[model samples]
Target chain A: MLYLEWVSFLGLLGCGLWIFLKLPIEASQGFPQKIMYLHVPSVITTYLAFFVVFIFSIAYLWKRELVFDQIAKASAEVGLVFCALVLLTGAIWGKPTWGTYWVWDARLTTTLLLFLIFMGYFLLRMSVNDRDKEARLASVLGIIGFLDIPIIHKSVEWWRTLHQPSTLFKVESGQASPSISPELYYPLVASIIVMLVFYIYLLLLRYQTEKRTDRLNQLLADTQD
Target chain B: MKTRTKFVIGGAIIFAVLTALSVQGLQEMTVFFYTPQEVLASPGKFENKTIRIGALVQKGSVEWNAQAIQLSFNITEDGKKFIPVYYAGVKPDLFREGQGVVVEGKMQGPRFEAHQLLVKHSEEYTVETENKKNKEDYYKSIQAQ
Candidate 1:
């Protein structure tokens, strides 16, 4: 699973870099500003993966299915990791462009909050002993907590904030502007597809690991009985 | 009207409220930038509005008043354009002339008043990641042979 996951992730990463490098020099902003593609897409994908967790959480609550719970937990775990990457990359980009790696503005603050919520979600899961009860609690929290993701995403615009306005996928342009020439856009889209493939592949591996752990736990209980 | 249905409806309401809050947040996340040339050409577009200006420090424009701990410099996107900036704050360690920089503040009167100035530096420090460093060292040894 590790090797397989790496292959898919690396391939996607390679494709993304290729597309990013191919962008015309005359595009909106020049070379150094290119980090936007990497940082923005990771943030977008983090939300997407966590939204999957929210849906699985709902399914787990409704049907009490262990499979749904597994999916929810796995997705949240991966989402948190991706969210961390978003912060790290954003900070890296921020330092050069914004002059500081951090600001307590709307976008940054809300992203930090979302990071904390996901951290709390994992901590809550660990503190529980009963498998079924843990799933029920986590499912409820996962479904509720994911509400913050979209809020963090849009906080910059809703308030008077010190963040940049959305440029990619703007209503004014059906696609990325000439600012993001096909050179960059193609790689960006490629990176996203690669990320999705890698994410799903990881989710399945983690779900299987959880199932095996549960089976081992059941075996121990039976032995005691 | 089962107990479970009520609980589900209550959960959905909570979800709706939180989603609305998040949507509002997502709308305001990015910061806009403008080069000195852009700001100068359409000062009207950016008039009285908070903005960031990017430029190189003009050759003879820097004036640091030690008493006030303020640093002043003229910036221009290109040599042909220039804007005077007055910043009264502790400058970043790497602040110097002929360097690229971004200043966040607003234009006031004839000067671009800066509330905050962050200096950018290239990454020269290396992280000691064991595997990466080790591999590079190994290749170097092979080349030496």
Candidate 2:
């Protein structure tokens, strides 16, 4: 299963790279617009990962299952990584376009808050000693942290921000129209798919590692007893 | 009430309060960037408020004094309604006439006191095919049209 996952990951990554390179350079942004392929995909995947964390967290709270908690932890860890990548890519793109590396615009501020919330979630998880109590607390935080996602999504529209409003999904008109050209749009979609697959693969690997650690702890306790 | 019911109600109340607070904050904090026409139509509303306006720089309106680091330009949305903008800073490399720009500042009567000027670069990457025409000739052609 692991081997197959790795092979498919490489295949999807190869496909994504091909599509990304083939995307036409934007007339105004020129080649710098290519960063959008990476930036957009990472953010989308980060949202997906966080959503997984939310679902698993709720499941853990409802069923009180260790497996659900494991899943939530794994997904949140992966989400945090992707969240950092999103910020990194965004800052890199902003420097050339917005003339500033960082701004306190609504979108940027909300995203930073999201990153900090997850960081706090991880810190809380590590600080707690009791397994069940830790899972319960983390579950609550995981659910609340997701509240930032909608705020982040709407920030560009809600505030006076330098960040451009939604280009892929314009909500006001109730239409799913993209503002970008088809050449750029297709590659962006391709990159999102590739990143989603990569996220799921990482989540599974991390979940397996968590299960192994739990089993090892059980074995050690049994030996001591 | 049962413990689960109590918990649910408490969570709902907290969520509602947070949502309300955020909604209120967003309404008060959101400063929408206005076009030149929008600013002109309601100039009284924007007085003393830090806001951003985006428009095309009017041709032949750009004046830069390098010694004082002062740049002045007129921006317009429809070429009929123009707003004079003054800034004292190193201008962006992309600043040019007929280019889209968004300036953040407060309105002082007829002139905008811009604290920051951002050049709105185009997203398209078309190859430059009309490089032979000089800057003045290009400006003249634009004006002639």
DockQ of each: 0.07, 0.21
Over A1-225, each residue of candidate 1 has an lDDT whose tens digit, in order, gives 778788887877687557555554422123545676567678877988789989999999889999899888988988899899999888887765556888765667778888888898889889998998789878888877787777676654454334454545433346543223354556667777777777778788888888898899999999999
TM-score of chain A of 2: 0.94
The runs of at least 3 residues in candidate 1 whose Cα sits more than 4 Å from the true structure, single-residue gaps closed, are A1-10, A16-31, A173-179, B1-85, B88-115, B118-145
Candidate 2 local lDDT, A19-96, one digit each (tens) = 555656565556667788788888998888899889999999889999999999999999999999899999998877
| True contacts recovered per prediction | 0.09, 0.24
In angstroms, give how far residue A13 of model 1 lies from its true place. Answer: 5.0
lDDT of 1 by residue, B1-145 (tens): 4965776788789778976886575444333346777788887887788887656677778999988999999986556878999999877655666555668898886689998886532211122222122223212211111
TM-score for each candidate, following the candidate numbering: 0.65, 0.80
Q: Would candidate 2 be rated incorrect, acceptable, medium or high by CAPRI criteria?
A: incorrect
lDDT of each prediction vs. the true structure? 0.70, 0.78
List the pairs of residues colliding in candidate 2.
A26-B124, A26-B125, A27-B123, A27-B124, A27-B125, A28-B122, A28-B123, A28-B124, A29-B123, A160-B31
CAPRI rating of model 1: incorrect
